[model samples]
Target: MHSQDKLIMIYGANGYTGRLIVDHALEKGLKPIVAGRNKEQVKQIAEEKGLPARVFDLDSVEQVANNLNDIAVVIHCAGPFSATAKPMMEACIKSKTHYTDITGEIVVFELGQSYDAQAKEAGVVICPGVGFDVIPTDCLASQLKDKLPDATHLKLGFDSGSSMSPGTAKTSVEGLAQGGKIRENGKIIQVPLAFKTKTIDFGNGEKNAMTIPWGDVSTAYYSTGIPNIEVYIPISPKGAKKIKRLNAFKWLLGTKLVQNFLKKQAGKSRGPNEQQREKLKTYVWGEVRNDKGAWVTGHFETANGYELTYLGAVAVAEHLLANEIEGGAFTPSKLVDNKLVERLPGTGEIHFKPE
Candidate 1:
């Protein structure tokens, strides 16, 4: 199925990352329907881009399914996906439309996995974290697993040189409210923010990194069957201390009042400009260790976060549309492979070694 043969809709097409995905899809010669809950905003964006529009919220599964009529796939970009993934996923399964999203939330990834049976039953593929959230890390983890098939523990880290979009900032706020997480012995468990810190060489010299509730904490487990996993991001010592301090106020941060206020502030900030997106880069590092203390390490480089999201999300949707992949939930690397990510625009060669 080519672009003209199948209709794809981009929900949340008015948001910053959503807009980037729309542009990428258009550049690939696809006429995707732009959609979101705000009728006026969605319509305005669609009109400006000269694309069709559909306005619907995830409040009701029936309503959402109705809006998805005749759409072959949906690139669900609206996030803080902890709140949106379940409903949108249910609607997608109900409507028998393939579902993909740019979510990096562990809860959302698990939520998608929970619907694997339903998605398979309905013959609809459900894939999330098709963006900067987990693509690079997921691919890294998969590669490490390939290098060390008996790996028992997996660690992934990333350093991105781009600014966050409003949606990503809001998602960061949501993540902060939830504290930190990691997968151990095949189960997810909560911990304090910045619970662990270390130095990692993500293609560059060593940098300080701290553990966060990155999507790979959940996705890498599924992608590589690694029973233990931890994901980290670059952070300064001061930043780590600040996050550690917030652990005492986790209750306040999780409160609706505080969350709403913080999200509002995050929403007001504009993301990276075109020049910034072009100039910045992202690096991913992964290591897998076995009971015998054997290990393998890998590193990858790619475009900036939002730029990778646009390229990765559109590419995943196009692949789903053109192929008859199995009907089930998947991580980005699990759905395709590391090669798919390696082939994206601005992706660099991957390096791996055993030690």
Candidate 2:
């Protein structure tokens, strides 16, 4: 399943992160067919990259499916995945094409899992969270699970001092009303933002961490079968307090007008440039504790989170195309060995130690 042999369609190929994926895919000499809802942007980008392009919307899912006729894989990159994941995945199933996306949305992962049987029946691989949100953490969960096979509880945290892209910011803004979430006893549990805070030691020292609705609440569970899961991202103490306070205005945040206003305020698609990504470093920590009260704590070091996301998404896609992946929904860690992520291109200085 080398690039030449597989024609991969990149939906939302003109957006910030999508363009990164497309540029990197081209650099790797992959045969990509770029598609998106925005015809002007999509065509301009396709022309610049000298790739074939198509424009379609999820509203006409059958039309979307038709355009995917010969494409073996589709990387759905347009998101606020809350609105995009289900429709794009349904189109993939309709087209019998393998589905992948650079999404870290909790609802997206859960939706992907709900479509597992259908995906398998359609002979398609439905995988989401092929990005910073869960790739490293999912692998960490797998690593910890291996060290503590009897592990029943999993806690994961990551700190990467990097800028967020406009697309990412919009996605977060889209979920302002829903608040934070976690997995307890395999059930999705909702909680207020920053409901839990702690000091997490991710290799160097302790940093202020707070609970977030990270995709691992779903992905890691599927990957490692950990019934209890909590994921945290670094936050300032003040920021943590602010998150909790924001919940009082959940109704205001949930309003469409507010979400749209924030989207408009976000301006346009943007991301950290190469030099910025090069300077950024990422750290991840995970702990798996069993009922016996024993636990294995581990840490992972990698390049920037977003950089790793670009590299990991493509690497996972290539691995899936070149090899045999089970037909159904899965996380990166579940589909490939934990070592696969550690071995990704540009992935440097990874150490997983049980303490």
Best by TM-score: 1
Clash numbers, per candidate = 0, 0
lDDT of 1 by residue, 177-294 (tens): 7899999899999999999999899887799999999888889988899999998888988989998999999999999999999999998988999999998888889899999999
Which lDDT tens digits does candidate 2 get at residues 1-355? 1234577888998988888889889888896998999999999998999999998888877888798767778888898788888888988888777888988898899899999999888878998978787788888899889889989999998888887788898888877789999999989899998979989898868888998888888899898988999998888999999889999999899898998998887657467899999888788888889999988888867878778877877887787778866578888887777776678655555455544
Residue 14 lDDT, candidate 1, scale 0-100: 93
Q: What pairs collide in candidate 1?
A: none
True-vs-predicted CA distance for residue 275, candidate 2, Å: 0.5
What is every candidate's alpha-carbon RMSD to the true fold?
1.6, 1.9
> What TM-score, over all chains together, does every model reach?
0.97, 0.95
Whole-structure CA lDDT of model 2: 0.84
**Candidate 2 residue pairs in backbone clash:** none
